[model samples]
Target chain A: MTAKLELRNVTKAYGKTTVIKNLSLLVEEGEFFVILGPSGTGKSTLLKLIVGIEQPTSGQVLIDGKDVTAMPPNRRNLAMVFQNYALYPNMNVFNNIAFPLKMHHSGNITQKVREVAEKLNISEILGKRVNQISGGQQQRVALARAMVRNPAMFLLDEPLSNLDARVRFSARSELKRLQQDLKQTFVFVTHDQKEAEALGDRVAVLNQGQFQQIAPYKELYEEPATAWVGDFVGDFPMNFVDGKGFRPEWANIGSGPYSIIIDSSESFGDIYYVFGRTESGEHIVLKSPKLLSIGSQLKFSVTRFKEFRDTPQSTVGNV
Target chain B: MVSEYNNPRNRKFYFIIAIIFVIVTLIPMYVLIIIAFAVPSQTVAAYYPPLFPSQFTLSNFIGAFSGYSSILQAAFIKSLITATIVGALAVALGFHASYGLSKMSNRMSALIISVLFFSTMIPSLTIAIPISVSFLKLGLYDSALGLALAQELVVLPMTVFMITGTLQSLPKQLELQARVDGAGFMQSLYTVILPLAKPGIFAAFLLSWMMSWDEFTFAVILSPVHPTLPILIYIDSTARGNILFASAFALLVTIPVIIITLVLSKFIKGNYLTSGVTG
Candidate 1:
């Protein structure tokens, strides 16, 4: 019931500037995947590429082993929910929902429109114009419009961002339930980490057009593949220590005056930095919340710390 | 200082201005209506001795409508047909052109739009000879269709630019949603762009039609044989020595347009002012 979507080292450039670098990720059949990032992080560009509204400068996009790199959005058989819920203003609710069926050479437009409207719980609004509807109802119409087409892949770019908070939460849950019930491949993009965590089966943490990490939400949040990913995935993202080290420091773990034991595998140095617990109840801000009695002084290695782009003065009571 | 709390003072100030404005504009209309009922000789001199007509009769209006052969009648019909057709065509043509212009890259489109506006300042005096000669060469001379076409050409750029401006201001998400919903080009335009641009379309058509109906120099130069209402009034005034007849004729020609504008005034917005007709 679900389709497979794969992006192989996709690159996008506009004139002299490139918005999306060589980026790749995959959404297996029936998986709800999300590309999560900050505002100008090329997340929407990736969604546009997949939806075929945009073409990659290099590499390819594939769905179910078929190449669709050069296809127009109309030929891609993928539906997208735009951020602003683009319903036809000239059309009433029924015609707006029926538009997809009409576009794709379907005969039973009425039946399909009715079905989608009923499923989305917007049947009552079928007679009304788009401007007359509420935001959440408009969102449902957009969703229904995208769904009515029976497309292979669904590309949603901040689909629920326009909704109020309570509506957003419910819409997300409903979207997830719908995706599961339909068992279709869904590639959703959002700047909100919580939305990604709640909706995506696999989350791709992107920053500055680069795929910093891609894994199931748990692994991406708990064990980030890159520093950027670590900083981006969590609720209050993983704090970073304003320091560095090499293998030389870690090789002589206890040899230094301030000895803190850390798993030195990822720390590309010989005792540059470490995470170890101390006598106090505080955990190392850099290190995981593991209780390691490294000594009285090296307690949690709680040193000069700040969040990403945080001011030093703010760390006073922030500790 | 609580200066804004003086409601009585504000009302008095506004009332005075309103009275002044009403008197300034309405006094002329009252004089004209009175002249419209006077004898031809009295129509001019006694028509406006600052109020009542010294000698009252409907002969001036009846004579204006009939004594001028069927020329005035033909001119009135010509102007009506031309204005209505021109307004409709200008608006219809504006829709597609504006859509394409608005959806294209913003910077390039903006430059193109600036150039279009710059061309609007082109003096009608300069273009008149060229337009007339071209129409003659193209075999569209002295025809109602030709007159309508000329009027459309005059109004098209502004209408198209206005509608395009409206379309640009519309949120892009609406177009995208229509596309995602499986609407093709026309469907998307009708459903999304068209509905959102109602105010612009209404304003553009009414304004363009008004311009076409009352335009004097263009109608005089291009289609003197098939003159519009404005040109006909000018001809009558020049042939005879009655500015009163000209004024009454001018007022007659202006009534339909005024009715249209007044009725549509409520809905005519920036885009409607610049784009196409409602239908």
Candidate 2:
């Protein structure tokens, strides 16, 4: 029911500009692998390649160690939930969910559809038309349609992005629980770091068509493999000064050898983030328990820092 | 603004204009009905023909069926078959062609559509002679199929334009989703694309049918012997100068168009192009 997916040196290019640069990856069976990247970084393109909607310019795509690069999307036995959900406008919700079963000529379509609808909590809306449902209901219907087929894996391309904030939070948890319940491989793609952290068993940070780091979200946060990964993985950009990189929480603002003139500060309840400049014009952000005013002098010390080389292509631990 | 438009004087003026517009547009149709239902004697009132007939009878309509070797019955059947063939051919060919066109870049598809439109602008009479010659050589002259193929020149361009717009407005994701749901290309088209495009396709079919039903140049040149309804009306009116019979034949020609339009009006209303895809 689940598959282990592999991409071997896959390179995709449009005209002369390459969008995916010789990328190789493996997603284990029943793993929730999240591809996290900013917009236009080929996140969705990678998903399409895995779903067989797109072919890699040069390399092979393998599912369960079997080459499937030449297979069509339907033959690949993968289901994809697009950002807009893409429900059939002409059909009611029941028919929309029953579409895949009908396509496969599977018997007991009504029973199968009812089971999936019950699991997705969309049984009440089965008779409603797609246009008559709200955005959240539409998303559930899309998921039910995908699930009804018992696909080898589910490929989700920003599936939660269209839902409102209130619904998105619940949808996120439901998606994670659904993946766990099915025990099916899921390749989820998103640009939101928080969503990546919340749902990914292992998040792969992609930038400029290459994976900067692929590890557990906690490891990606504590020990990022690249300076860009560190900045991209957290809420705030990691502070780098004098060839030393430290997270905001890793630096203390009370007293130490280094001193700075506070330029600005923002308070979040009991804690504060102070933005300051050193005498050598190095900008640093440090977390403080007490709120500090602007234009004030403060001393800070870095409890721990990663030394990055001064070269333009700075990788982590290049001391 | 609403009050000004609804003022008593302005209301009266608008009412008079509306009445004049309706009367101006409906006068020819009204006269046609009057002549068709009136007896021959009432239709020929010397110098001052009466607007309304003194007596109504089905004599003119009855005369159309019995007069002229039963040509009206034959021509009516021929026109129906020819128009039905043309409508089917245009929709079948246009839907597929437009699907392919919709996948191309906007500039590319536009260039091709404009070329198709340019082909339509060339007068059909200019090519009618050549087509008739080819049809004769192919041994298809004076046949319903030949007439239908010739009328395709008049209807295909509009069908392609309309169906292309409908297909283009649909999100490509639906088809892609269908494929992911274990469907082949043809399956996705029928299951997803065709249903969404029903309204446009029906509208295009209706227009094609009406155009083919009324087409004169191709019908006259290509199938003069096996004349369509329009040709039958022309022959009866010109040679026999039977205004009453011609009016009855013309009225018969409009029956199918009216019925088809009424039956398909519900399909054309509120086409659900934007509902499935979120903004």
Candidate 3:
């Protein structure tokens, strides 16, 4: 079953240092919400707060309109998959999946575990110890353990981070499919913007214990709400000139008003990413169709950009 | 150069050194066995005793268990029961205490553990009198329960230190995952933490048991009337100069230790502390 989750002005601090500032969020009953931020940006802390592992310093955590802020993690009835899977090393795959159901005294554990195991394609390994399984299979067992209970929501903390590149790619799609098929609320936390874009119905970009922007991944990439979000959300940090920020693709190289001396370039098969410094000494990266020689000057034109300001009240829309 | 050190000549030299080390360590135990098996006439009359027993007999062991109201038999049972209880209590109490400490800040927990370790530095004799006085006042001086509790002072520090290491080695995420999986605190502890920490807990138990089994100072002072095996051995050997009987009793004390070690060698070899949390 799915449940809408809401945090009303949650702020979590440990003594003198605040790990999460006053923040609020809402996830629709069946939406896949991703919290995307770099490491040490309180992304994991946010998930812990929502899952009731760490209490918020000041705020109410409401699940389906009921306050659960003071409830213990078990009482909150939410499932979480840790970054490391955290499968019971003492139990086999079958028992690991059956643990949650047994905790709730849910009958028919054998059939339930088999069903979820089959769905995850891990039925064959049900008799194997967790340590005997591959990382990919362990991840599936963690998911199977989570899904068996059909909790109100699922909170994932970088669950795909430990997988190899190819496995991670497949696991990401499998996770998205699982969420869609179940239609359950999933709040996933990770440092990878690519994963956020791939899975999130709405991505909240966090920085310095606060959210910089909460919007769709496309909106975040095209029109980041703040300079920090612009710098963080893309493969290349957005280039800023004279208090205005623009993505690398927004600047056309080799024939424009602004001039820069090429420092280096990286090729990506069809195109090159040229890195250089402008006349005013601002570092800029621009996309180039041809290889650009180092030390050669190039001109670029900004097709679109957003103006930023020292104060938070500055207009943030694209110009 | 490395291969030169690994030559057959050097290898033989190392083999000889290992044999010498083993002999040096085992000499006292070997002599104890020889003395235990030697006939009373051979042991008492000989000025410089032979390395091996001149004659073998079970009379010393039988005499200790059956002679003079059988004090050794009663004391043997007392020591076994007390040690087993102490082993269990130490593990039970130590694991809980260590789990609580493990949740604290590393510096805070380390400070507490160091304080616990310092308690062991004081000779048991210093506290034995005060403890026996307290035990007398509480009517627990000669009781096995009291002896077991008193022995906790000897074993609890080491137990906590060891189990704390074991608990810390396990990933904290597993416990958290158990909680999130709908298990309550005690439930998760029993279902996840306890099983994963078995090796360390058993090791701590075994150490406590052996320590209590051979403990003398507290047993002599607190339970003088009933007397643990070590105390009985002390009294018999000194009061009667029964070297043969004492050696037999000493050998009897090591039997359980040996059997326990053999049985739990599997757990010791598991190396669970280092490898418990695999990805």
Candidate 4:
């Protein structure tokens, strides 16, 4: 199937510094594509390129197979939810959601606004101003405003970053379900690995204006193409021993070759991590279901380890 | 621990300052009231301190109001028309200029703002003769519209400066979001930017109206044929030489400005801009 959005060798530079270097990707229709990275990794810049807010210095942005690199943001027919929600402070919930429809001069605006508001479960607070509602409701209003246009794709720039932790978890699931129900292309950007692992159909790890790896979360974690990708995509960062990758779960207590003295153990509810050092004084963590006493000795075996070459640091900018 | 203001010594200091402030500000109004109610005999008979209205007669107010009833009515209408036009024009033109200035580089914005500031600093008296000559040549003299246009030039600089501060405070993301939601430039400015800028515009309108309402030099020079409230007040005070009449007219002129300031002050508090923007 043809992709809904595609970037061809896009590059964005500011004077002497290049923020996004030669990068390209395709987001298929109905795919929940995520660009995961730490702050200032050119993730938001990439979204701006697609939405036509920031022009790429040299690249082509195609939406539905049309080159839209030169198009203005309003003409791009794509909606973006900013990190701060960016709701019009002067407008109430109903007017805020109906803003897009009024822009297009779409017929039956009241009906269309009501329909979107109902779907977003903000029907009761339609009369309340955006400031009167909670942050979660404001998020829904922003989403409803973007949805009233029914654009071809949605670009969310760290949409849930402003919410509390509990709200963020529930909002993540709601966003995923909403994407599934609408079957529209969704490109989400975030720095949290849990969000990328839980929400993306295919997660792309970006660093310093370069796409390190793009694949499903499982493959990116279990079979990372580079050492950087392996370090970036796990809840607990993957351990590197002698330039080789070993997942915490792959280490087991046995009579194989490696022997280690237990240093400490930390528990995170159901799972515990046992910190240990090999005989040669290499630090390693063994994932265990039960707690282990500190300062104990044990022989451990690694089921397997993945060998990865380090992607040279010279190619990407200093950011 | 006790707050500084709650201490006895500091409380005494505040009491003294409050008494001084009240005396300084209220003395003028008290004198004006006494003069308005004083009888003609008090001034002509003897130059005593007419601090109290010993003989309260409605004749001074009646005489002052009746003498200039026709001129006062005409001047009141002319001033209203001029002030309203000046306020609207200042807001419409000044808002757009301020928004444009807010987006410029800091050095450029500062340079342009300073230029506008200096333009306002040039006293209106210096330009009054030139403006009067130009207005007479252009056939714009003796017209309320001409007076309003003249006042607009004076009020616009301050209006634009105040509006620039307000626009700078508002986040630019709201406009960007409007653009991404499919609004054109003019549409976004009208729908998104102006509504959020209501406080600044309110303040600009208030300042513009107040400035034009009490303007004296331009009203005297360029508008000799079409006198405004200030010109009539000038005629009543200097030519007629009736303190009671002048006091009554001054009070009349102050009422509307006070009413407008009270009503629009609610909108100019600067609290609404950040209400729904930040959590």
lDDT of 1 at B30: 74
lDDT of 3 by residue, A1-319 (tens): 8999999999999999999999989899999999988788798999999888889999999999999999989888899999888888778889989999999999999999999999999989999977777888988998999999889999999999999999999999999999999999999999887899999999998877888889999999898888777777777778877768888888877688789999999998899999999888887888888887899999889999887654222212211
- Model 4 scores a TM of 0.91
Q: Kindly report the docking quality category of candidate 1.
A: acceptable
Model 4 residue A213 CA deviation in Å = 1.1
- State the TM-score of the second chain for every model: 0.80, 0.89, 0.88, 0.89
True-vs-predicted CA distance for residue B273, candidate 1, Å: 15
lDDT of 1 at B62: 68
List DockQ, one per candidate, in order. Answer: 0.26, 0.70, 0.54, 0.66
Q: Which sequence of candidate numbers ranks them by TM-score, best first?
A: 3, 4, 2, 1
Off by over 4 Å in 4: A1-3, A254-264, A275-283, A293-299, A311-319, B1-23, B40-54
| Candidate with maximal TM-score | 3
| C-alpha lDDT values of all predictions | 0.72, 0.89, 0.87, 0.86
Q: Indicate the TM-score of model 3.
A: 0.92
lDDT of 1 by residue, B176-264 (tens): 65555566667777866787888888878887888888876668778987777888788778877666667668668768877988888
Q: With candidate 3 superimposed using the best TM-score fit, by how many Å does residue A293's alpha carbon deviate from the native? A: 1.9
Ranked candidates (DockQ, high to low): 2, 4, 3, 1
Clashes of each: 22, 0, 0, 0
Model 3: colliding residue pairs:
none
Tens digit of lDDT per residue, candidate 2, span A173-227? 9999999999999999998888999999999999889998899998888988877
Which candidate model has the greater DockQ, 1 or 2? 2
What TM-score goes with each of the models?
Answer: 0.80, 0.90, 0.92, 0.91
